[model samples]
Target: MANDKHEEIDPRFKIANREALIGVGLALFNFIWWFAFAYGLGSKPVSEYHYILGMPAWFFYSCVIGSVIMIILVTVIVKFFFKEVPLDDEGEESP
Candidate 1:
């Protein structure tokens, strides 16, 4: 016997998907920023390298500064764009 029941999808899933995409986008942006700084500045000879706060320019910009930037961005995005949705199934009940 084949049971054919089509239950409507929850609307919260859409919001969740959008938030997930934003996370992926942020990750991609982080990767590009890291790659550009790490390779573009790190390609120079050691003798020609620059220092920032006693750290190599490439490392400082790629790892240290990049992390601070990402923290701020994530904080802003979550605080402004993210929603607080209920995790339980109570909202799915029908009258």
Candidate 2:
């Protein structure tokens, strides 16, 4: 018996899937990183407000560094988990 409800997929589905996942993943990572970097909302505010190597609490960039760290973590995760695809000349699939 034919299961007519089943949908057919193109042979190149994996290529599109990887590209889309990576694109969205990178975009999401960048957005989260940027917000974290700009807001500086995480962690406790410095009570001392003293200069740590000539940097004040409000002026210091622990959040920015954390965002960078987040990006690195995402990058590593994507690299480790995602499959690799080779692009053709002009960065388009060769027919």
Candidate 3:
């Protein structure tokens, strides 16, 4: 009877929950940085780097900072909140 109940839950459920939290966190960062760059206060790129792409310095800085922040958040989430579960072949939770 206990086995029957345990068999109803998949090990992947915990993984999915962790992933959903990470997705939501990243989505928030996307919203924040996009708003900052597009509608909020950003560095005034009065100067441009004479690179091959001719991109503004502020844009480059934003990209670097954004990448660093995303990496940090992902690392924190994976390290702190991730849960591991062993599953059976039939998608059942282990005892």
Best by lDDT: 1
Tens-digit lDDT track of model 1 for 1-95: 12122122566676798899999999999999999999999999999999999999999999999999999999999999998888777845553
What tens-digit string does per-residue lDDT give for candidate 2 at 1-95? 23232113332456667668877877786666656544553333666455546765333444545467666877886778666545433543434
Model 1 spans with C-alpha error above 4 angstroms: 1-9
Cα lDDT computed for each candidate against the true fold: 0.89, 0.56, 0.62
The CA lDDT at 58 in model 1 is: 99
Sorting all predicted structures by TM-score, with the top scorer first, yields 1, 3, 2
Q: After superposition, how far is residue 6 of candidate 2 from its true place, in Å?
A: 16
- The segments of candidate 2 whose C-alpha lies over 4 angstroms from its true place after superposition are 1-8, 40-53, 56-67, 86-95
What TM-score, computed on C-alpha atoms, does each candidate reach? 0.85, 0.41, 0.52
Give the Å shift of residue 74 in candidate 1: 1.0
Candidate 2 local accuracy as lDDT? 0.56
TM-score of structure candidate 2? 0.41
Which has the higher lDDT value, candidate number 1 or candidate number 3? 1
RMSD of 3: 6.1
Per-residue CA lDDT of model 3 for 24-86, tens digit only, reads 978898668755754332444445333224554445445655677777878887788776656
